[model samples]
Target: MYPLNLPPAQILQLSSQLLCSGLALLLVGLAAAYGLEKQLNVPTLVLAHSLTLIGPSVLKIGYVLRLVAQQRLKDETCAHAIA
Candidate 1:
């Protein structure tokens, strides 16, 4: 499902990175949003909200990429073994 035509290992690597980044973003966003709620700062709140929205999307994409990569790797191994 990913757009990139990369090897399964490469996709897996990229997905791992994305998962880390997404988790970090999600935690930071949640903390920022909670802590900044009392400040009533528009820009900061907007940034926090943006991060909150983007984090889950990135996580989902990363998860899907991981699944696809793993599936491809499994298929490749099975094909090679059967040959």
Candidate 2:
């Protein structure tokens, strides 16, 4: 797990990196689909795209869950320190 203590700038950079990668993947998928339209069936193409997007969607959910868990741990630690 990545440390949430990462600097804001670093976090922003990581996020932008992920965003660009996802965009690139989408572009590549689109290009391939366009190029292979005659060879690939439309339903199969759509299904593959749908399944491929699930991976990123799950990744996003996992990231959010980690952030939430980190926040909760931080809150607990601070509370313990203040008591």
Candidate 3:
């Protein structure tokens, strides 16, 4: 668990790290798509485009999952507070 006293600078740094990691994953997925198209004898152009299309959806799903987890945590906190 993260310390509750985390400073704004530390938060910003963590945000930057997450953004960079996400970008790296996106690039790796693209590269994998390219390789799959070439090695699997599929249509490279179409698969690359599909990768672009699917990448955002994958990221959004991750965002949704994070939101759900956060929401659940918040609810638990509130429940504890009330009790």
Candidate 4:
């Protein structure tokens, strides 16, 4: 929501990369969480791990949608520039 005023192309590129990174991190975190839950069986660790996994998943989905929007904006920009 903060306006960095980056061009749509940059936003799309950066957000796409960030989205991928976020997903990779989410997978790793989930794996760790699974291990901790199964091996340690601690309730506090379970809650913390769940929150960590969930927050990033939300952020990753947001970035994916942001990238899509930025790509659409870039396409429209190109169209207008051409016409």
Residue-wise C-alpha lDDT for candidate 4, range 1-83, written one tens digit per residue: 53446666776667776677776666766766765666655775666476567658766765866866676797788999999
Residue-wise C-alpha lDDT for candidate 2, range 14-79, written one tens digit per residue: 656665565666565665566666777989677557645754664574456456555656866899
CA displacement after TM-score superposition, residue 50 of candidate 4 (Å): 6.4
TM-score of 3: 0.53
Report the candidate with higher lDDT, 2 versus 3: 2
lDDT (Cα atoms) of all candidates against the true structure? 0.90, 0.61, 0.58, 0.68
Those runs of model 3 whose alpha carbons end farther than 4 Å from true positions after fitting are 1-25, 28-42
**lDDT, residue 14, model 4:** 75
Kindly list the per-residue Cα lDDT of model 3 for residues 1-83, writing each as its tens digit: 43334443444455455545556557766776765555654465565656666666656655544554555567668999999
TM-score for each of the candidates: 0.89, 0.47, 0.53, 0.53
Candidate 4 worst ten-residue window by lDDT:
1-10
* Deviating ranges (above 4 Å) for candidate 2: 1-41
Clashing pairs in 1: none
Model 4: which residue pairs collide?
Answer: none
Residue 4 in model 3: shift from native, Å?
Answer: 27
Best by TM-score: 1
**Where is the poorest 10-residue window by lDDT in model 3?**
2-11
Tens digits of per-residue lDDT for model 1 on 1-83?
A: 55679999999999999999999899889888887777858898889978898999899989999999999989889999999
